[model samples]
Target chain A: SAVISQKPSRDICQRGTSLTIQCQVDSQVTMMFWYRQQPGQSLTLIATANQGSEATYESGFVIDKFPISRPNLTFSTLTVSNMSPEDSSIYLCSVDNGAFFGQGTRLTVV
Target chain B: DQQVKQNSPSLSVQEGRISILNCDYTNSMFDYFLWYKKYPAEGPTFLISISSIKDKNEDGRFTVFLNKSAKHLSLHIVPSQPGDSAVYFCAAIGSNYKLTFGKGTLLTVNP
Candidate 1:
């Protein structure tokens, strides 16, 4: 098991602005995934962060909107660009070996 | 296609009673299956899992049963506890490489 930490646990942001969320892991894990969960909804996979390479996004998501960066094995960052109300949701980071989540960053775009 | 599906959105069970959560997948290619539990304001946590080769896996009060032929799986928690009340997620990972998840089933344990 690994201990993952994510910053900006909860934030209220303005529309058209952007906020970058950071994730730090206690141990080096090969896989790091980003997920978004809207209120009363299920979790949707945004992308898979690979160290030193561009993140692999899921079908409905794009890099232009949700830019991701995995600079190293233990750290990654996700920037929600040009936020909107539709973007208001709980953003979580998970690692491999079953789903281990951080506290989660709740973003409320106004 | 909705590869993974948790038909029931919510389930209510009394404390000390048995709680059963069902999950089904449309994709026959799935080789690995797992269950995760989540609480509000927190990320989902790993619970139990059963691989394609195994029909059952158990841990403490939790047990997972897989019926590969029906493309279905279920998580059973004996003697439900207050802490076990949370959103439970069903996930599968086939040779395709990535794990696909179901919407999740909210289990409410009334004390």
Candidate 2:
């Protein structure tokens, strides 16, 4: 199983501000998944980050609001632009190898 | 609409007993299903997985049963332990490695 490290484990930001969460995998993976878990809700797929291409976003997610970057196999970043109170949630990155997930970044927009 | 659904929000089981968690999916294209356990302030960890080809798959004390016709799947943990208390999530794998998850069921095992 691969280990994932996520930065900014928790953050508090003002409305309209932006925050970028980083995920680093111990081993190179072909596909990295980003998910959001709202308060008392299930995990929702944000996008799939693939190296050397534009990420594929889910139906409710857009590239402009939640831009994703996969510079390489072991690294990816998710940026929450113009965040609002509803954007407060836990963001996680995962790899399919036994579906390992990072500790997660808990963002709170005030 | 949610592709996967877990109707029960929580479940309680006695230690040394069997714990059954259920999940249902509306999508017919899903070919793989997985179970994950999550603790507070942490990401989910994979528990077990079952492909659509098999009806049942077992590992140690954990077993997963899938019903293709019913579009339902269940995870059974025998002789449940206190450490097993956590939020359990069920996921269905779709195209391009996309996973649709159900609202998790929090399982509490009491000794």
TM-scores for all predictions: 0.94, 0.95
Query: For model 1, how does the per-residue alpha-carbon lDDT over B28-100 read when each residue is reduced to its tens digit?
Result: 8899998999898788888888999999999999999999999999999998998889999999988866778
- Per-prediction tally of clashes: 0, 0
TM-score of chain A of 2: 0.97
Candidate 1, A8-108: lDDT as tens digits? 89999999999999999999988799999887677788999989888999999999999999989999999999999999999999898446888899999
- Chain A TM-scores for all candidates read 0.97, 0.97
Q: How many steric clashes does model 1 contain?
A: 0
Name the top DockQ candidate.
2
Tens digits of per-residue lDDT for model 2 on B30-72?
9999999999888999999999999999999999999999999
* C-alpha RMSD over true interface residues, each candidate: 2.0, 1.9
RMSD of 1: 1.4
Name the runs in model 2 displaced over 4 angstroms: none
